[model samples]
Structure formats: structure tokens, C-alpha cells
Target: MTGSLQPVLAGVVTALVGFASSFTVVLAGLRAVGATDTQASSGLLAVCVLSGASAVWLGLRHRLPISIAWSTPGAALLVATGPVAGGWPAAVGAFVVSGLLIVAAGLFPPLSRAVAAIPKPIAAAMLAGVLLPLCTAPVRALVEVPALAGPVVLVWLLLHRYARRWAVPGALAVAVVAIALTAPPARPGSAGLWPVLDPTVPSLSLSALVGLAVPLFLVTMAAQNVPGMAVLTGYGYRPPFGSALRVTGLASAVAAPVGGHAVNLAAITAALAAGPDAHPDPDRRWIASVTAGVGLALLGLGAGVATTLVLLSPPVLIEAVAGLALVGALAGALAAALAEPDAREAAVVTFVVTAAGVSLLGVGGAFWGLLAGGLMLLLFRRPRPATAPAPEDGGTVAGAATPRQPGRRPGRRGVPAGR
Candidate 1:
């Protein structure tokens, strides 16, 4: 009983930490994309249920700790992209398209390879650019509303210094307290507490497809799915990459009409369930992911409340918390983006264009950033000399034999015979 309970507790913690750490970012992204309060709530609920289901299915089917999550980085991309040409419906359509792209990547190896062939530094630079503004929100909040944001920042700092893992959550708790104290109390029976799916009829637009869908798919694949597989591999689990992508892609498509943006494999939260802390035996760690899936599904029921909290709180305060959660991600992205000296200049171009948040010709900064970076890389990258094929057993160069003395080997120059 104790053995079973340990994994269950770990799973619960995984779900809690995953949800608490970044749900604000999800909401903010949905809002930025023009989702209404109710729509954002529906998006939250849908992703939780879909991601939870994917996690549960993959964990059981593969018997591996395959954790799933909504694409937090993709959400950040949406936040950066802001409203599209056709409003929220177009965004929904873009979500559907991105889901299809993910499914295609899973089904077609060439497509997956094409996506993988994107230079890592350029991808990381684009992500870093998208993350820059959000990561600065905490400082802005500190300056703008010090009284409300001060305690939250202080708690986060203290915990960040000592605990690290609980830093964002600690800050979130204080922010909740501040909200409860300052914000007006909710009237009884004013809002429903149960999860609600407010479906929208998706309408496709060229700009949304190019600017939103493409970038969302790329960001989700590069930042979330890839890192997720790496996390599982690090824990000695060989993730079923194709199957995971298919499952998550299908879930994202199904949930998109109802406001869910995207769902993919979990990266940071994966370590919780896949790690030894969940189980003494590695083989049994799947139970932790399964339990976490159920917990996340259960947590989906509270989306209404979570949405209400966001609607009630000052947006900047919530942004500050979300920003705090993303600082580490930003740092990691920047480091990876600049790691290759040859790619540094191109990466900088990508980062600058993306961080500029400028839109041109109806396309978002992310797409432009990547395009500019790729061009820079192509134009500025130094060409390498062609590698020559290795010699055969006789050490010939390009099938041409070297002249040598009749009694001598290749490296016995000036030596007496039979020495």
C-alpha cells in the first residue's frame, strides 16, 4: 500500500506543479489571441483533459512514463503573435492546422526530418526572442504596482534562493493572497465552477495559417516535444516519439474547436513522474505518469475557477507570475541559441527580429525572424572543403598508387633491409 501511495503522491505533485507553474501563461496567451474569458477557460479545460488523456493512454500503452502537457511555449508564441486577421475563429483554425501539421510530422518521416533539419540555434533564438518580453514582466510589475506585486516577488525571491523548485509556485500563492485581499469578492452563484466547453466554429485565414499556425507548430515541436523526449531519454525511458506525436496531435485537433490551442509531451514536468522519486523500479514509473494524467484530468474541472481568478486579478500581476515562470526557459533558450560560435550572428538576427515583435506583410515576427536567420546563415556561413574518401588497403590516394622502392613498405624510407 505504501509503495503504491508513493507514486500516486508523486503523480499528484507533478500535476500540481505543472499546472500551477504555467497556467497563467496559457490563459494570457489565449486572451492575447482574442479568446474571450469563457473561451480561455474552455481552452484551459480542454487542454487539461486532452493532455491528461494523452498521458494516460501513452503511459498505459507503452508502459513508459510518457507525460503529456499543453504546449506552453506555443502559448507564449500565441501571446507574442497577438490577434490575427480573422479574430479568434481564425486563431482556432490556426490551432487546427497546427494540430494537423503535428499529425503529419508523426505520420511522415520526411516531414519530421524537415522540421528537425531546422538549425537548432535559429530555433532557439526565435524562442528566446518570443520569451524576452514576457520574462521582463516581473520587473515591470515591481515598478508599476509595487504594493501588490512586492510580496509576490519577495516570496518568489526567497524561495528561489533556497528551494528553487517551489519558487514560481510560492510566488503564485502570494499573488493569490494579494488578489483575494484586494480584488472584489465573487458573488455567490455568479459563475459556474464546473468545466465548460464553449465551442467556436473555426474559420481559416491565410495570415493566421502562416503567421500563427506555422510558428505554433514549430515552437511546440522544437521546445516541447523534443525536450520532452530528451527528458524521458535522460531517465532511461525510450519514448515512443511517433505514437506520442500522433496521440497529442489528434487530441489537439479534437480540442481546437473548443478553444484548446495544442497539447504535446511534457518536458520539465516529465522528470517528476519519470524520475526515481516516483518509483524504486524504473519499469514501474509508468504508474506515476498514469496517476498524474488522472490528477490533471481532475484538475480540469477547476478551469472555471482558474479563469475567474485571472479575470478578477490585475492582468499585470498574473503576467508577472507567468514571467517569473518563463525566466529559466528564456535563459536556457538564449544559451542554446548562442552556443555555436559560427551560428551566433544568425541567431542574434533571429532573436532581434523576433524580440522586436514586428509584423510585416501580415506575418508575425517569429516567421520573419526564422527567415532572416536562415538567410543570414546561408549567406555568412563559411563553406568547408570537401572531405576526401579514405584510401584502400594499399593507401592509394584517389585510386593512384604512390611510387615506392620495390623492397620497401610505405613508411620504411632510408632503412637498411632486414634490420
Candidate 2:
């Protein structure tokens, strides 16, 4: 019973963090991309439903801790992309394309391989740039609303230094308390329960396809799915990669017209369920993920309440909390980007160009950053020469004919003794 309880607790903890920690960023992203409050709520609910279901299904089917989640980076991409020429409807169309692309990639191993072929440094750098701005929310909010932001930052700093895992949620708690204590009470009727689906009839445009859809697909694939798989693999749990993509891709399409972006495998939250805290027996850990799914599904049904709390908060404060959540991720991405000497220059180029937020031909900086970085890699990457074959025990290089002894076989590394 104690053993069973541990996984259950871990699952609940993960779902709480998964839902509360980054939900604001998801809300902010939807709003930034022109979603109305109701539409945003609906979309959030939609994502929660799909992701939760996927988590449960995959976790149970494979007996692996296969947690699923919305692409926070993709949401960041949507935020950065802003509105499209055809507005929200066009953006929805782009989401559909991205969803289909993910589905297609799952169906075609070559496409998945191609996505995986993207250099790690460039991918890390691009992610860093996307997350960099969000991580600054705390600092920016400190200047704009010190009273509210100060306590939030202080809590985050303290928790980050000590508890680590609770840092973001703890800081968020502080922010909420600070707001409650300091801000004037909301006027009557300022908030209400509204969950309407303002469905968009998706319309495609060249600008949207190139600028939004393609970049969105790349961001979701490179930043979310690839690393996500790495996390799952790290946990000693392997699921069919193509199937996961298909599930998420189809889920994305289902959620798109309503408002949500994309759903994929969990990243930060994966560690919570995948690690030892979830269960001692790796075999039983699937229960943790399933538990997380059930919790998320319940939360999704109440997404309006979750979204409303965020809606009622000060935008800067929300940003600060969201940014605080991403600080660790941003730091990790930066370290990866600068780790390799051969990739450093290209990585830096990618980071700067992405951070600069430059757009060309309607496409966002992320695409351009990757393109520039890839080009830089071509010019700067040094090709390592083929390794020399090791000498055999017989004192000759591998595959070299050496002096033959009666019935003597090729020695170590397939080399015969003295020619």
C-alpha cells in the first residue's frame, strides 16, 4: 500500500505542477495570438483533454511513464509570431497544418529522422532565445510593479536555491498572495463562468504557411518532441515514437480550430513521473503517468476556473510568474548552446538572431535563426577525419596482412600478424 501510494502522490504532484506552473504562459500565448477569453478557455480545456487522454493511453499501453503535454515553446512561438494576415482564423489554419505535419512525420520515419537530424546546438540555441524573453518577466515586473513583483522574485529565489522543484509554484503562490493583500478588490460582476467555443473557419495564406505553419511545426518538432523523446528514453521507458506523434498530431488538429496550438510529450514534468520518486519499480511507474492524466482531465473540465484566475491577475505579474517557471530551462538551453566549440559560433548566431526578434518575408526569427545557424555550421564546422584502425595483437593495423603462422587467425581488430 505504501508503495502504491508513492506513485499516486507523485502523479498528483506532477499534474499539479504541469497544470499550475505554465498554464499562465499558455493563456498569455492564446491571448497574444488574438484569442478571446472564452476561446482561450475552450482551447485550454481542449488541450487538457487531449494531453490527459494521451498520457493515460500511452502510459497504460506501453507500461511506461509516457506523459503528454502541450508545447509551451510552441505557445511561445505563437506569442512571438503575434497575429497573422488573416487573423485568428488564419493562425488556426497554420495550427492545422502543423498538426498534420506532426501526424505525417509520425507516419514517415524518414521525416522523423530528418527532424532529428537538426543539430542539437542550434535547437538548444533556438529554444534559449524563445525562452529568454519569458524568463525576464520577473525582472521586468520588478521595475513595473515592485510591490507585487518583489515578493514573487524573492520567493522564487529562495525556493530555487533550496527546494528547486517547488520554485515556480512557490513563487506563483507568493504572487497571488501579494496581489490579494495589496490590490483593490475586484468589482462585482468583474468575473464570470464562460466557456464558449468561438470556432474559426481556418483559412490559409502563403504568409501564414511559410511564416507561421512551417515555423510552428519546426518549433514543436525540434524543441518539444525530440527532446521529449530523449526524456522518455532517459527514463528507461520506450514507446512507439510514431504512435505518440500521431496521437499528439491528431489531438492538435482537434484543438486547433478552437484555439490550442499543439500537444506533445512532457519535458519538465516528465522528470517528476519518470524519476525514482514516482516509484521504485520502473514497471509500476506507468501508474504515475496515468494518474497525472486523470488529474489533468479533471482540471481540463474546469479550465475556465483555472484560466479565469490567470485572467484576473495583472498581466505583468502573470508574465513574471511564467518567466520564473522558465528560468531553469533557459539556463540549461544556454549551457547546451555554448557547450561545444565547433557549434558555439553558430549557436550564438542562432541565439542572437532569435533574441533580436527579426522577421523577414513574414516568417519569425526562430526559422531565420536556425537557417543562419545551419549556414554558420556549414562554414565553421570542422570535419573530423576518419579514425585509423587499431593495431591488432599481432602488431599490425586492422585488415593488414601480417606474417602468417600455421593456422593463425586474424588477431585483434581483424589484422593478421606480420605480412
Candidate 3:
């Protein structure tokens, strides 16, 4: 009995951390795009339910740990772009387009290849740019509302130095308690005080389609889903990327009417549930991810309670917590963007352009930055040299690499006889 507890504990913590750390971002993103209070809460609820169900289904079907999450980068993209010209309805249309693109990427090899062909540095730069401004909310809240923000920052800093995984959760716990103590009685208007699906008929507009739809699809795939697959691979689980994308895309489409943007594989928290710490036996770790999915759905159903609690504080407090939550991701993106000298200049160009929040020709900065960076890479960087084969590779490498030079004699086409 005691032996089984570790996986369960890890699973619960993974779910808790995933929710507490990012839900505020999702809510803020919804509102940024002009989601009404009901619509925003509804979107949050739908995404939670869909994410949990997908995670459990994938975990059970593959017998592998798969933790699903809302697209944090997509949320940041929304934050950076602000509300579209036509408001929330148009944004919902773009959300639907993004989901369809995900589905297409999975179903069509060429589409998937196109997404894969995006340079890693450019993608990393765009993500870092999206996250940079969001990660500064803690500083703003500290200056604006020190009494409220000070304690949250202190607890976060202490826990970050000690128990890194628990840092954001600890800060969130303190915020919840503090808010509850100082908060006024429950408000009269919240989405029915329970999870309810309030669907909106989507309206398509050119600006929303180009600015929000395409970039949302790109960022969700590049920053979250792709790396999430890599993270699962790092944990020794080779996911069938095609099927994973397809299912999650379908889930996203189903949830979009209610404001859910994108639901995809989780990279950061996936490690928490997929790694050895979740369970000694690798085969049994799926339980943790499955448990996480169940936990996410439960949290979704109870979102009203948590939402009410969070709303009591000034909205900046929520942003502060969210900013703190995203600090690690921002750091990672920046590091990856500049990791190689060849791409460093191009990556910096991408980061600066995207962060500058420049929009042109009805397209957002993310797409332009990526386009500019890719162009720079093509012009400046040399193609990588072909790799040499290991000693064990035998004749396959010889045939591919040596291919009998045009003037060489047949008897000694490839390498010197003895040297």
C-alpha cells in the first residue's frame, strides 16, 4: 500500500502545479481577447475537462505517461497581440482555425514537415519574446501593491531556491489564503457558480485569421507540443507523434466554441509524472499521468471555487503569480535561442522583433520574426556537415558516403586498402 503512494502523490502534485501555475495565464489570455467573465470561466472549464480526458485516454491507450496541457505559448501570443479587431467572436474563429491546423499537421506529412522545418532557434526566440513581458508582472505587482505582492514573492523565492518544483505552488497557496482572509463575500455573478458550457458562435475575420490563427497554431506546435514530445522521449517513451497530435487537435476543436484555444502535450510537468520519481517501475508511471488527467478534470469542475478565490485579489496578483510561474520557461527559451553562435544573431533578431510587438500587413510579430530569422539563417549559416558512421555501421555507411568516386578504380573505390 505504501509503495503505491509515491506515484499517486507525484501525480496529484503534477496536476496541482500545472493548474495553479498556468490557469491564470489562460484566464488572462481569454480576457485579453475580450472574453466576457462567463466566457472566460467557461473556456477555462472546457479546457480543463478536455485536457484531463485526453491525457487519460492517451495514457491508457499507449500504456505510456502523457500529460496534456493548454498551450501556454498560444496564451502568451494572445497576450502579446491583445484583442483582435473583431473581438472575442473573431478570436473564437481563430481558435477553431488553430485546432484545424493542428489536425492537418497530424494528418498530412507535408504539413507536419513544414512545422518541423521551422528553425529551432527562431522558434525558441519567438517563444522567449512572448514570455518575456508576461514574466515581468511580479515586478509590477510588487511596486504597485507591495503589501499583497511582497509575501508572495518572498515565498516563491525561498521555495525556488530550495524546492524548485514547489515554488509556484507554495506562492499560490499563500496567495489563496491571504486573499480568502481579506476578500469580500462571494459575488453574485460568476458562471453559475459551477462549470457550465456557454458556447459562442464564432465569426471569422481576415485580421483574426492571419494574426491570431496561424501564429497560434505555430507557437502551440513549436513551443509546446513538439518539445512535449521530446520531453516524453527523454523519459524513454516514444510517442506516436501523429496520433497524439490528431487526438489533441480534435479535443481542441470540440472545446473551442466555449473559448478553449489549444490543448496539447505538456513538456515541463510531463517530466514530473513521467520520470523515475513518479514510480520506480517505468511501466507503472502511466498511472501518474492518468491520475493527473483525472485531477485536472476535478479541478475544472471546481474551477468556480478557485476562480472566486483568485478574483478576490486585484487581478495583478493573479498576473504576478502567473509571471512567476513562467520564469523558468522564459529562461529556457532564451538559453536555447542563443545556444549556437551560427543562429545567435538571427535568434536575437527574432527575439527583439517579436518582443517589440510589431504588427504589419495584418500579421503578428511571431510570424514575421520567425520569417526574418529563417531568412537570416538561410543566408548566413552553412549547412551542417554530414555525420560519420560508427565502426559498427559496416557497409551501409560505406555505400552512402564513399559511393565510388568518379575517377577512382573499382578495386579501391572508397578508402585506402590498409589506411
TM-score of each: 0.90, 0.88, 0.88
lDDT agreement with native, every candidate: 0.83, 0.76, 0.80
Regions of model 2 farther than 4 Å from truth: 182-191, 387-419
**TM-score-best of 1 and 3:** 1
State the TM-score for model 3: 0.88
Off by over 4 Å in 1: 186-192, 385-419
Best by TM-score: 1
Of the two candidates 1 and 2, the one with more favorable TM-score, higher being better, is 1
How displaced is residue 16 in candidate 3, in Å?
A: 1.0
Model 2 C-alpha lDDT per residue in residues 248-367, reported as the tens digit of each score:
899998889888788887877877887778887767888998999999877777667656667667788999998887776677778778888889999999988887777788777877
Determine which window of 10 residues in candidate 2 has minimal summed lDDT.
392-401
Give the candidates in order of lDDT, highest first: 1, 3, 2
The lDDT leader among the candidates is: 1
Which lDDT tens digits does candidate 3 get at residues 187-216?
Answer: 544655687778999999898898889989
lDDT of 1 by residue, 327-381 (tens): 8888888887888899999999999999998988778899999999999999998
